[model samples]
Every structure is written in C-alpha cells, then in structure tokens.
Target: MKISRLEAGFNYAVLSLFTISALLPLVGVVLSALTPRAEATGGLAIPSSLAWSNFKAAWAEGHFTVYMRSSVIVTVAVVALTVALASAAGYGFARLDFPGSTPLFFLLLIGLMLPAEAFIIPLYYNLRGMGLTNTYWGLIAPQVAQSLAFGTFWMRNNFKQFPTSIIEAARLDGASEWRLMWQVALPALRPAVLTMCLLLGMWTWNEFLIPLVMVTDESLRTAPLGMAFFQGRRSTDYALLAAGGMIVAAPVVIAYAFAQKHFVRGMLGGASR
Candidate 1:
C-alpha cells in the first residue's frame, strides 16, 4: 500500500532531521581536525588555514602505524576465526538434531548476555597463566570467544531458513555433510557471512577494554587503545586528539561504505524470515 503524501513528507522530514543531527558532530570533527591548534578549541568555526599538519602530528605522536598494524592483525584473525567456528557451530545447530542440542545452544546464548567487564579480570589472569599475555594470542583468543556466540546466532538464523528438501536431495546424491554445507548452503549465506565479517571487524577494531587489560607492551596496543593513551597524554591538544580519532575511525567507515549493500540485504533477509 502506498503511504499518503502527508505521511511521506513527514517521514522524509524526520529522516532529514536525524541525518543532519548525526552529521553535525562529524562535520565538527572534520572542522576541528583541520583547524589550527589554537582555533580548534574555540569550537566549530572555519579556520584561517587548514592545519594539514595535525594528521601528521597525530600519526607521529600517537605511533599509529604500529597501533594500526596490531589492529589489522587482531581484527583479521578474530574475524577469520569467528566466521570459521561460528559457521560450523551455526550450521550444526540449525540443521542437525543431536542430543542436548537445544540445551547447548541455550548455553551458548548465555555468552551474548555476559558483559566484557564481568570476565576481563579472570580472563587476564587466565591468559597470563597460559603465557599468552601481552602477545597477539592474548588479544585474539578472547575476542574470538566473545564474537562466537553472536556469530553462531546470526549464521544459525541464516541457515535455518534453508529448505530441508534441498538438503536431503544433496545428501541422497552422496554429498557429504561438509560438501553440503560449504558447496550448497554456504554460498546462499554469503550476504550473512559478509555482514557478520563487517560487524565483527568493526567490533574488534574499536575494542579497547580487552587490549588494555591483556596487553601491557606498547607495541601491541590496538588503534582504539593507542588512541586512548594518545588522548591521555595530549588531552589539552584538541586538534591532535580529533585528528587521531579520525585516523582510527576511517578504516571502519571505508569498509562499511563498500559492504553496505550486502549488509543491508543480509539484515533484511534475516528479518524477513
């Protein structure tokens, strides 16, 4: 059914207002980042000249190159591990009927409710005992575990919508379980997989708590954690801090821009079922 002209106009007006509200802060950040040190703190005024040096200063002072490298390694590893394990677990839960399946799935769902603050202390000590502290594994392992519950839930929802008849037909044709999952079902779950990857990458990229607690070595600090320390030292330097924030936020924004179509499709597909 078509909406009335009044409803359509009202919806557009509301959306436009929300869009402007969201964009104003970002525009302020851009302005602040480009403003000279003295003018940046003065609020959202156009600067006399673009302080292009703020980004360079932020990069150099923040040691963002090292932090970015660490972030990339951790984010890629977490997303890869999460997708691999979550897909298998999700497919199993969605398609199979083993003993204790429901109970186990519910147990896994408990992880979704648990907060990082609740487990970070014990997790830190546990990683230290395992000799993983201050290493990439220390950061990666917990994030993978943290991501798995939701990944499993997301993938399970995607897979559960597959037709049982098609699965049975593939099995009858001598397709092994692995073949069925990877070759048949997984291809159809591409949108969901991409969406999960995007979401997990964003979460891992922005994560500060896990890295802060588990990593004491300066070199292993991820972007967000590094930016936090950078801000602490340069708290008075608004231009530099804003520039640092932009640097940390840019990659995720670029990635989301590219994958937004698949992301939207995946979300709508899941919700429709």
Candidate 2:
C-alpha cells in the first residue's frame, strides 16, 4: 500500500511539472502585456507598474477590430462548411452503399494522411483560376477543403461505431434516408459534433498560412497575419507584441474554458470507439 501510494504521488509530481511547464509561457505573455509599452524589451521580469493601456495600444496599432471581423467571417464559414460537408460524407461512408463509394472514401481518407504543404502551389493556381485571390471567398474556400479531409475522417469513424440496428428499424418504420440520418443518427452525434466543432474552430481561428498566402490586401488580413504587420510597425516594442499575443489567445482560451468538458468527452468517445 505504501509503495502504490508513493508511485501515485510521484506520477502526480511529474504531471504537475509538465502542467506548469506548459502554462509558464502563457503566464509570462499575460504579465508582459499588462506591463508598460516601454518595458517590452525590459527582459522577462515583471514591470514596476501595470499598464492596461497596452491592450488599447495593441488594438489600435494592430487594427485588430478589422482583422477580427475578417477572422470571424472566415472561421465561421469554414466551420459550418466543414461540419456540414464532413457530416454528410462521413455518414455516407459509414452507412450508405453504392458503386465506388469505398474507393472514393479511401481516396478522401488518403488525403487526410497527406501533407497540406504539398498542395500549396496547386492550391494557389486553383484559387487564381477561380479569380478568388485576395478575397474572403478565396481565404475560406481553401481552408474548408483542407479541414474537410480531417473532418470527414473524424465523423466517419464516429458513425462507424453506431449500431446499424437503429437505422434499420427506422427504415422499417417508413422513415426516409434523410429523416433517419437527420432526426436520428445525427442527434446521437452530439459528442462528435462538439469535438469536430472545437477542432475546426481552433484551426480556422488561428490559421495564418492560407490567409497569408491567399490574401495580400492590408484590409483583408486575418488576425495572425495582421499581427505580423503590427509587429513590423512596432518592431521595437516587445511589450505591444506580447499584448498582441494575449489578445490573439484570449478568445480561444475563453472558448475552450467553456467547452472543455464536452470537448474532452467528445474526444474520448470518438477515440475509444
């Protein structure tokens, strides 16, 4: 009994060490953001005075409000498209049967394993052909495509775990295919939906690569790309950059904080099944 207790205690100590290690940088950023702009380069120590004005300065200098709008529009659109398309594709792969369905699904699943960087050039030209470069549609369309690969893969696995008995019973009760999927199978997918929503939302929200590559207009920048410009302009000020980091991370932190429980449950359910 003593040995088991000691082992458990040691494991907890390791876990605590890891947890603190992960959080220290975030804490430092927050502290730096709250300090005066002049102290941005004043090393890692806490400043003598707290300066709430740093947040305002980051906001103004970064043009965060405009970038935020662009970010929201892109994120929301991508999430919605990813979920809708992935849910349908996932359900189809798991439940429906037709010619070439398996092969087509395999092609999509293969895409999930492929690196997105491999497609950057092709994607760029494709966007240019669509005449969508430097626009919101160009920004969102590609993100949706990149994210859909994983989304479909995620939902496909989840749907596979659901018993077909219920679906068959619904079919016998005069339910159409759409009705069975929408009213029955989908309701049981809450955990998966939550998991996917959280995943896609985070990815799309924090995305910089696609936006940076596809968009060039200063007015159309997403938050992270906009922050790069902000940094260039305020390159001498480390405090403002730290504050900008805080601002960028705050919404994600708040969202995860609220949805944490469901997020964990969803991940476990999908993985365990």
**Candidate 1: deviation at residue 249, Å?**
0.3
Model 2 TM-score on a 0 to 1 scale: 0.94
Question: What is the C-alpha local distance difference test score of each model?
Answer: 0.93, 0.85
Q: Which lDDT tens digits does candidate 2 get at residues 1-273?
A: 356888999999999999999988877887888878766663667888999899898898889999988888998999999999998888888888889988898888777776657887789899899899999999898889888889998888888887778888999999997787778887887877987898898999899888888989977899888888888898878789998878877777788898898798888885332
Model 1: how far is 49 from its true place, Å?
Answer: 2.0
lDDT of 1 by residue, 56-82 (tens): 999999999999999999999999999
Most lDDT-accurate candidate: 1
Q: What's the TM-score of every candidate structure?
A: 0.96, 0.94
Query: What are the runs in model 2 whose C-alpha is more than 4 Å off?
Result: 1-3, 270-273
- C-alpha lDDT of candidate 1 relative to the true structure: 0.93
Worst 10 residues of 1 by lDDT: 264-273
